[model samples]
Target: MDNPYKVLGVNENASQDEIKRAYRELVKKYHPDKYVNNPLKNLAEEKMREINEAYDYLTKNSQNSTYSNSGSSYANNNSSADYYSIRNDLNRGDVSSAERKLNSINSQDAEWFFLMGNVYARKGWYDNALNYIQKACNMNPGNREYMAALQNLQMMNNSYRRPYNMRGYSDRDSSFCDLCVSLWCADTLCNCMGGGC
Candidate 1:
């Protein structure tokens, strides 16, 4: 086991409250929901494990034995490391290999699309990234993780300079509303011109 304080990102002499604060911040950053079905979910889980261990070690011998994981903590049923290793390989900068591995995956869910988008993004294939991330969003429109990935793809291209980059949206400048509205209007006009209505 690594030093509890170091694992929790706090000084050894940190007060219990200080340690708790650091742990909470890390939890917020690596929460499972934030990365649900993410290719990096495994990495986040590893981080959560470290955080859990640190909290346990510090709380077991401390006067304040009030430490608990804010959310579910299950280490037994984690996915095989083969999948995670493939994710890491993508992160290591190999799009072709990543895509090939992705092709072999049976669990093609939102995370899979998001990861494919990541590989495309790294290879400067913004168009492909956009398409894959859009598929991810379509798969899980309610999931903020997939939403964020699609947003990132939009922001990466054109820096959101022309339209989707509306003010108050965010640094990512992601928005399909404006584009969708425009396309809808165009479709409506085309329908009006056609006599096949």
Candidate 2:
């Protein structure tokens, strides 16, 4: 393994708080849930494992005092981790599992609605998807992720309508090309957040 300080992206002379902060950021970035269903999932898991080991080593070896991850002290704590796991299930094409997990969560924050919208979208329930995503956007007006998801849903809705309007065909007859373009745009949006799609 690399030097513990280097692994956590901190220098040897850094204070404990600096090390903790860097570790937290890296944990969020490389969490296994973030990479699940991506081609890089295994790499992300390995990186996370490395980070945990480094964090443990550094905290344990601190000369003045030893700190340990006692569950509550970690950055990607349980509640956030639960959300990440739901995202992992969704990306893995396990909408049912994701939905079940989401439903079990009591809080209905912007993230919850956004994820529910994604599940509805996956299940081809466009009306429900739009409603939930719109609610998410309303709850957190400044969130780009919610906005992008809503736009992607709207684009898909428009794509389905354009074919029926122009060719007098059913929405099911929408061109595959339009669908692909919409998906490509959505994936680009997700990529801007560091990972997804």
TM-score of 1: 0.40
List the candidates' TM-scores in order.
0.40, 0.51
For 8-74, candidate 2 gives per-residue lDDT tens digits of 8877667889999999999999998987789999999999987887777566545422233321111
Query: How do the residues 1-197 of candidate 1 rate in per-residue lDDT, one tens digit apiece?
Result: 32566778877567879988998999999887899878999898988987886676565434321222321111111211233445556756766877887787666655567778888888888898899888877865655656777877787685645564454575443546667788999899899889646
Best by lDDT: 2
Residue pairs clashing in model 2 are none
Q: Highest TM-score: give the candidate number.
A: 2
Q: Which ten residues in a row are the worst by lDDT in model 1?
A: 71-80
lDDT of 2 at 29: 96
Alpha-carbon runs more than 4 Å astray in model 1: 1-83, 160-197
- Clash counts per candidate, in order, are 0, 0
